[model samples]
Target: MAETDREIKDSLVRAGRPDRVEGRHVNMPVELGSTMVFDTLAAFEAARAERYRSGTLYYNRYGNAASFKLETALATLEGASAVTLTSSGVAAITLTLMALTAPGTHLLVADNVYGNTRAFCDGVLAGQNVEVEYFDPMIGGRISALFRPNTAAIMFEAPGSGTFEVCDAPAIAEACRAHGVTSVFDGTWATPVFCRPLSLGVDVLVYSASKYISGHSDCMLGVVACSDADLAMRIRKHVMAVGDKTGGQEVMLVLRGLRTLDVRMKAIDAAGRRIADWFAGQPQVKRLLHPAFESCPGHEFWKRDYSGAAGLFGVIFHPCADDDVRAFVDALRHFGIGVSWGGYESLVLPVRPVRTAQRWDEPGPLIRFNIGLEDTQSLIDDLDAALPLMNTGLEA
Candidate 1:
């Protein structure tokens, strides 16, 4: 007799349980609480002592069982000694930077990293008297030359924002080790499924769980995973102090997303490469910026280090009027205009990429693309119709 769909799903779910849970299944019940109650004064004192020594939670502000399980799962994926959950990705970045760097320390950042990350370093960290230095996204091992004695940490985002230049993460990690600086990678692009930052010698790994981890664009959460005992303690303490905690439902949603992560990512990865290859052949597209493609910056590094690529990539079109370019995007029937990537639905955003550090300017206007779970033929048709429209003569 054949098994029912529900029974098959249950069995499939059992097969993908996180190893660190010690025989526990992927479905963990949420534990909601404001304040935990103790029956005896001795027990209360014991709890207080535990809270002081280990930063254990007596209230939801610190954490609950749902959040704790999420942290444990993330830590297991990152190969870190521990992980701390935050309300959002920026919260993780803010709290981690606040805990790791002193007011007078220096920070080096990738030029094409997420705009808000650069904003945080400049507006928040630099405002506190910390020196902020921007480096080319393709700096790789050459990053060592810019390190100063007061440099506290280095941040990286692989296949960086807009242009999708894959950095030499291992080389950067080595440079960080030589300078005795903490290395943090925004692993939201690859997540733990494709890249393990700790395995490559990065000190800390951060994620914006709102993207792929939740898979539905519903919840916003962040996770910081690290192997250093001291750094883990610092992040936990900082998160608790600021009350940057995710709720039980969000925690459960992320957990549910994790169960099908392998399946979802496999589809996205395969479909993305197909669509990217098709875009490369279009005459209107001057260049395709995808780490998996040979023409991409740091392609060799991505081939060597990363096991797989995500659904996001960038494209440069032949010089055209703004309206023409907008019409090209508007012509697409499948892809939607959106701010964030990493959802089940495809998206496209036009960008005017400029050179800040070096001469890596685009021949034409730039646009970022996120390939979704749509059929490859449908996405190809949408792009085919859109690319020709971009080359039309414009009335000034």
Candidate 2:
């Protein structure tokens, strides 16, 4: 019988138990090794042949038992045919692009994607002679107009990293399918808990497990889940060629984080929504860029497809000096100023939207908030105390 996602997640925690030492271990043991031994030359040769044919573990760089356990759990969660775990999120993106695009291939990317991704496209991919184009995040079905015969892939990110502009992922995915263009979605914002891109017709789903999957600020990991077996194999081959394998200890940490992901996501979501509602009433705020809110771009698409929202969103402050913006962020006591979200600690960061193919003309300074597992009232109080800083030299 088919189990629910929650059930699958829970079952995975104890699914692949190690062989009984006394009785049975509740979790898969971390098998750290660089080489595998066989009883005879015949067995060793057979294993080598099998590894070449199936791409199984012949070396640690290929992946260990612990990494495979986490990969299995993530693949099942995403409802993907296969998964490739990489050293980091950017590595996953790099590997996926390397596997799919060759020289002279055109790749269409959402304009509001993570800044580093755009840098990768501009720097590395362009250096290799790949044509990169950035389109509006809200383009939806119109994305097809930008495709050419040589267009190899479309990179998408719903509720784009800093601006919180949601994209019509399903519409875009359908358009890509019609044109035979591969679709790669950055699912880090929603993870698999709130949104499943594979079900929405995305060919590849990439995630920065460094954030929500780790659920802590420690380990760095990334995962690429593919609905197409051919693409999955290609990505795996690229990863192997690049020697991009996550550490066993880091994989175990991510596995531990997955165990509590459901509850943590719900708690963080509730806190974020509550804070966003509060921000809506603040006079200094020009607009709230949250997908669950009406003012966010492509909100209708979010409402139509997503089951829930995540803890990250943006706040566009009413026209204020850059100094005031700095003061507001610096005054916050509870929220740390840093990049990356989905951890247990609240964070705030000043963001300046950067676009080449499109214009981001918000009338005021933008600040992104990452709600964390702190007391709601304390967080609200912190914001209330800091918001006055936005008006700080103006009243004089």
Name the top lDDT candidate.
2
Whole-structure CA lDDT of model 2: 0.85
After superposition, the stretches of candidate 2 with alpha carbons farther than 4 Å from their true spots are: 1-22, 52-55, 392-396
C-alpha lDDT of candidate 1 relative to the true structure: 0.79
Per-residue alpha-carbon lDDT of candidate 1 for residues 1-396, written as tens digits (9 for 90 to 100): 003334333433443244465676547665667888888988888776665223365667777666776776676666678788888887887788887788889988888878778888888889999888888978888998998989999888887888888888989999899889999888888876677778888998887888887787778888888888788887778777777778888888888887776677778999999988987777677788899998898999889878788898998777887888888889999999998878789999986554456666565788999888889899998888777778633211
Model 1, residue 43: what's the lDDT? 83
Which regions of candidate 1 fall more than 4 Å away from where they truly are? Answer: 1-26, 52-57, 392-396
Candidate 1 lands at a TM-score of: 0.90
RMSD of 1: 5.2
Model 1: how far residue 200 lies from native, Å: 0.4
TM-score of 2: 0.94
